[model samples]
Target: MSTTVTPTIKHTALSDFKEITKMRLSLSVVFSSVAGYFLGADTISLKIVLLLALGGYFMVGASNAFNQIIEKDLDALMHRTKNRPVASGRMTVNTAFLIACVFTILGIGILYSINAQTAMFGAISIFLYTSVYTPLKTKTPLSVFVGAIPGAIPFMLGWVAATDNFGIEPGTLFALQFFWQFPHFWAIGWFLFEDYKRGGFFMLPTGKQDKGTAVQIILYTVWTILVSIVPVFGVTGQLKLSIVAAIIVLSLGLVMLYYAIQLYKKMTEKAAKQLMLSSVLYITLIQIVYVIDKFIR
Candidate 1:
């Protein structure tokens, strides 16, 4: 009789690296950064755009990886996040920590090579996201507000990377994204209320997905719409939007508002999901409109 030996497969560091980065989310973050770069830069260069996107991706990815490491236990409790690499035991805490460190350093270094202002913003985003927002999620509903600071930075960071200065242009970009986040996240909170509760996260402003929360969502949605159209008035300095773009953006906002109202009336998972989808479309469409208006006008 002959005995056969089976070879054991060892996990590669590269596979673990991908898991820690949360590639899908990183890509989305990079998209926003690139959109901001396009809108802010006077002349868009492919090389700079690529660098900003990659740098933004690594910075946001590092924040997310550290967040997972910090919230691994809580994540295990939530069905939506239970299978995350760290929470599921597929990646160890030490491994995740090292990956976060590497990404953070690489991200900041790349951004610094472009401009120091961008690098500083990137570092601050990571710090606020990981050090403040992650732990605050379970302690207070205000965590969303705290997280928005870092979340809104990407758009402005792109501007700083290109222009090497922070002014009305980047400020407007920051404000638009800042207001946009409230509705986007609240819609998500509405849909994931149950899952969030499992992890002791108070994501909704009212701490419950009820009429009050829905009202707040609508209020913020209105504010976001107003800010998005501000540039059309041509008073926002370098960041100006045209009448056509304003109309297009307003139409998208109305669609989002319609879904928000529907969610308010029905207060069901389906309605919340629709609102969430609409929120996503509203942001993306408005960003594209801003860039288009910049070139057209």
Candidate 2:
């Protein structure tokens, strides 16, 4: 009985840690950084890739942990987030704070070993996320814009880690992600508007699922698609994309655009959910295409 209980308790603790870190989301963020690293690196070094992935994960985890700590009560109010470790009362604030601190220290330290610039960007991302974005969630719809800064950093952060420089190439990578997030998040905000409202979050541009919000989503989705193909125009420095890759990327964007249009025309929860999932697939596939094109070209 004692042995079984001990194992169960340990398992629960492990699960709580995963929840606090938002492990799946953190891994996805790390994937962006790794892809950027590959794109920017002249010669791939497994050591740098490993360092970037680990440090990137730690930084994203710290931001999520801090966000949970800050929004514990608000999270409890929302049905979607109510079961979170902190919001559910299964994890104490102090424990979560300790984990956040450890992650922050280790993350920055590891990134610093890569380059001062990489560490600086990582620190900025965490600061913006936990300090500005978390607080502004309930205040203004502009919070999404502010949040996009940190959210867009991982891809560029990889380029910086690989090259130790901030240039047109990394900037292009940053712009592509920055624009993509608006439509992705707006789609989510559309479908989950009520759940977010329960938590006092005003995520949509119009604060309601209206034509005004749908138009902005469509506009930003177009902007994202355009930025994704700009590399083919030979204007984005070292970030050149082959014509074939650009066409594939354009096709992927069109698929997302179709869903965005469906949401606008239908204005139903189902359409919004479809757009949300399509946006996820779009970003993931676009990143993969960019990396593969670089290596094969």
lDDT (Cα, 0-100) at 111 in candidate 1: 88
Q: Report the lDDT tens digits of candidate 1 across residue range 1-297.
A: 999999864545665566678787788778788888887788988988988988998898899899999999999999998877899898889988888999999999998889889999999999999999998999999999999999999888887887898998889889988988988898889889999999999999999989999999889999988888888787778888878889999999999999988988999988988988888888888888888778877
Best by TM-score: 2
Candidate 2 ranges with C-alpha deviation above 4 Å: 1-11
Give Cα distance to truth, residue 105, candidate 1, Å.
0.1
lDDT of each: 0.88, 0.95
Looking at model 2, the pairs that clash are none
Q: Which candidate leads the pack in lDDT?
A: 2
